[model samples]
Target chain A: MANLSIRSVSKSYGAVSVLDDVSVEVEEGSFVVLLGPSGCGKSTLLHAIAGLNPIDSGTIVIGDRNVTNLPARERDVAMVFQSYALYPTMSVAENIAFPLKMRGLDRKTSDEKVVAVAKLLQIEPLLGRKPRELSGGQRQRVAIGRALVRDPRLFLFDEPLSNLDAALRTELRAEIKRLHQSIRRTMVYVTHDQTEALTLADKIVVLKAGRIEQIGTPLSLYDDPDNAFVAGFIGTPRMNFLRATVADGGKTLHAGEASVDISHLATRLEAGRNVMLGIRPEHLDEKQGVTLSLAVDVTERLGSTSYVHGMLPSGETVVAERREDQPRFGETITLRFLPARTRIFDAQGMRIR
Target chain B: MATAASDPTRHFFQPIIVCLTVASVALTLFVIWISLHDLSLMRAGREKFVGLDNYLRFFGDPRAMAALWRTVLFTTLATVVEIALGLAVVLFLDRDFAMKRLVRTLLLVPIIMTPVVVGLTWRFLFDPATGMANYLLSLAGLSQVDWLGSPQLALYSVLIADIWQWTPFVILLVMAALESAPTDPLNAARVDGAREWQVAWYVLLPMLRRALAIVALIRAIDSIKAFDLFYIMTRGGPALSTETLNYYGYIAAFTNFDISYALAIAIILTIFTNVALLTMYSVLFPKSGER
Candidate 1:
């Protein structure tokens, strides 16, 4: 296993800069996920790491050697692409054995390794079949097998499971986790799905507009985001933000007709200062306490849990999970927010007290 | 009335058509009657019902057999040269470049020019003493060549001129196929660690096989019955070196007044063309069930 270090990488096409001064360190035997929306430079970063695209300025170090100028073959990195990139002309066995042949391994050893990887991915029966004959999940397995046969220093996956259906995606997600546990190799995965990044990564790098917004463990980013963008991007239903004014010696945040107690907050707060308060939907409860009255607009019940999408007194939309499915449309109910579960951000989107 | 209205085949030959058909039949019969008035002359006034004697005489003639062989040789050489040049031009223009649009438009100059005009132009350029081709060669101290004088070199010279004029037809079609090829597989090849040459050879060329087959079919069919260029340039002169079947038919019917022999040769050429076309179709559209 080798740690991959990217130092000050930048890329541009003509005048449009795609990746600017991006740097990250992927520890050995760890899963590093680059997460972002489309056109946000996540795939470009993965391509740069795989040596498919040349960066304007950067040093890409795989273990001890700097592979900044080396071609993809010399870098000893295998990539699983979004479309699974299995050679249509070759059978699964030949596709898996391609990298081994490229590395000058003998025929016998290459076949043995191909067999081993096919078995690991449970695609042994598909060895003789072409990619077109297989289903999407099967194609994905062959793509991963092609990467595994090389046993390279680092493995790169660019949305390898994006083409699979939701059910198949879950199945392959668990399979990949188990594979990582068994092989314990350094892998850099790039995806726009936050769930994939949260579940599969040892360290998640959230990006926006070609810049790294936050990099941390999943729970850390979930519990404590650095800015409004990170807080909004990291969670499932997305963190709810409300415009509020600090008042009463900074002990209260008044938003429309409701006020939230922030007296126990350790960070400095000033009166009359404008700020944004964020709370996750799961943290909202129906118990009577300091409450914000909201008019229920719709409740989407997903058997055992329901999401009450409603408007708060401030006219801002908020989503709250109803554990017992008790809320109905047109009902105005007061939803309680725990003091410790709230996060505050200044007008500039930076987190504040 | 209902039975007559429900008959589906009623429109097959609605009348006013039957009267016209009878008139056409009578006219064709009268023309055939006048044309066959001197049919005995085709058999040297020997007897009626010649029974394939004209065809037999054509097969027995050394000049006819030589013309047949020369036609095959020219077609083969011209088709091969045309396909190779077309494939080269296609591969070159497939990529994006500064002057690609301009070059593509310019390449159409040769293909769009009338074939007869192109042939006449090349004939003038290949003239022995005053031609530009010989002028350039003389400047290099090479002997001036009689491009259409020698029976051996005349066919080859015509083949060169035809290749120059028609290779662009193949290039335009093949270039379109190459440009729209899926980018996913190519990128996958690179990420799978393939060299650029390998990607071009294994992935790209195989993907272009269907287009290449079409180009070959078109060029071959056009080359087999090539007449206008050959007739305009040499008129089967310099000892009948470039006398293809089309030109041979023209000579036998018009020049030698052997209409029966000409019709027999035309029928034989038709059979050859039909077989070639069938073979080409089967080769291009094999029942692989890809659809």
Candidate 2:
């Protein structure tokens, strides 16, 4: 196990800066996931950590040693590429043993190590087959086995499950989690998939563009997002937002067709200001506190639970969760949100309590 | 049905088309008949039908056997050298460098030049008394060796010219293959901790096997029938050292006036070339289960 410290890492391609002054500390044996959308530089950060890409400015310390200038082979880390870059010519056994061979291990010791890794990865029967001869899932295991046989200080995975189908992704996600538990090695995984980050990571580092948006556990980010971007990006079927002006009605919000009773946020409310109001679908009740009459537009029924897409008379579209026996499309329905579940974003898209 | 007949768009027999097919088949049969007319002259023109007489005489004659051996030796040696040098140049030019296109164009000068012109140019350079090659060797205080005059060295001199002319062809084709080589496998090999030599030896060479095999097979067939260089340089001579099978067949038909023997050699050579091509194909494209 090893701890990793990245200090003010920066990268640029000629003139375009990709990562800027980013720093993070990964504790020993921690599973840290870097989550973001496309071109957010998450994969670049992972590659920088794996020493596959050189950072223009930074010191990367691993296990009390500075490895900033070390080549990838000497950095004592193993990376699983999204493409599962298994050597096409080598059999599964030879591919696994390649790193060990580079380290000057004798044939006997390396073969034993390969066999052990194959057994652990459940790829023993595939030892004699080439990469082209195997299916996608089997090829992934061979790649994992190659990484495992190295026994490096850190494991870096760059969207290793992205190439797999949905069901296979789920299966392999569990397998990776189990492997982490058994090995307990420090890992830095990069993915744009929020679900994978939420399920597998001890800490998730959400990024936007070239900056870190927030870093926390899954529930922490879900319950208390720092900004509108994090709030919108972290959930499925997404949180719904309503555009309206905030005005003082004694101790409650007075805006839109209906005044959302926000007496709970009276201390934080400012009079006569435009703000964005957000509420998650799961937190909305079909009929009940701060009420808005909705003209139902579309209802998506997923057996036992459903999503209702509707609009206020003011033409503000919103999605609300409902049971199967909910209102049909083109009908009038009333939905409400608990005052506690509502989130307020000021004019600049900054979160406000 | 009566209206269909009145349409005049249907014919029971298309007379003009029938004439065309008969004309085409007649033309083909006429060509074959004229080509085989002299074949009977070699077959003894009797019921005897001495099956393998000319073929046996071709193999039995010492001068012809010598030509056969020389052709085999020259073709094998020249093809090997051409492929080896060609692959090296291709690998070198495949990298990013200044003047790459210019250099490649310059290298292609020999390949695109007429073979007879290349041979003529070298023949003048190998002239023992006045050629620049002998002058340069003499400047180095080395004794002047006969390049085209000696039976022993004439074939070697011709081979040098052929290699200079055709090795660029190998370079061009192999360069195309090298440029399109997949980047993923090379990157994977680097991550898997292979050194530069290992990457080239273990990864790249295997990928190039098919391309190199194709180059070798094509060059082999081309070199076996090689004539223009030998005709322009040594004229199959000093004492027939560079006389290949083609040259031998030409000499038999024209110089010795043994037209029947020459035709027999031509048939044998055709069969030999076909067998070589088949063998190369099998070697390159093996069964699925066999590696």
lDDT of 1 by residue, B1-291 (tens): 788767877777556678789898887565334333335345666534456666677689787777777766776677678777887777666667899889889889998899889999999999997888899999999998999888878988898899888888778887888887776667666666678777777677767778877787777778878888888899988888888887898898888776666766666666777787788778776757431
Candidate maximizing DockQ: 1
TM-score of the second chain in candidate 1: 0.81
- The most accurate candidate by TM-score is 1
lDDT (CA) for every model shown?
Answer: 0.83, 0.83
Instruction: Please tell me which predicted candidate would have the highest lDDT against the true structure.
Output: 1
User: What is candidate 2's TM-score against the reference?
Assistant: 0.81
Q: What does candidate 2's lDDT look like per residue over A1-353, in tens digits?
A: 34999899998887877888888889999999999999988988887887778899989998898989987666788888888887776789988998888778999999999999999989899999888899888999898889889788888898999999999999999999999999999989999999999999998888888688888889988888878888888887688877867666434555467677666763556677778888888877734577877899899888888888988887788888886467887899878777678887777777877
Score candidate 1 by lDDT: 0.83
Candidate 2 Cα deviation (angstroms), residue A1: 9.1
lDDT of 1 by residue, A55-150 (tens): 999799999999999887678888888888877767899888877766678999889999989888899999998888999999999999988887
Provide a comma-separated list of chain B TM-scores, one per candidate: 0.81, 0.82
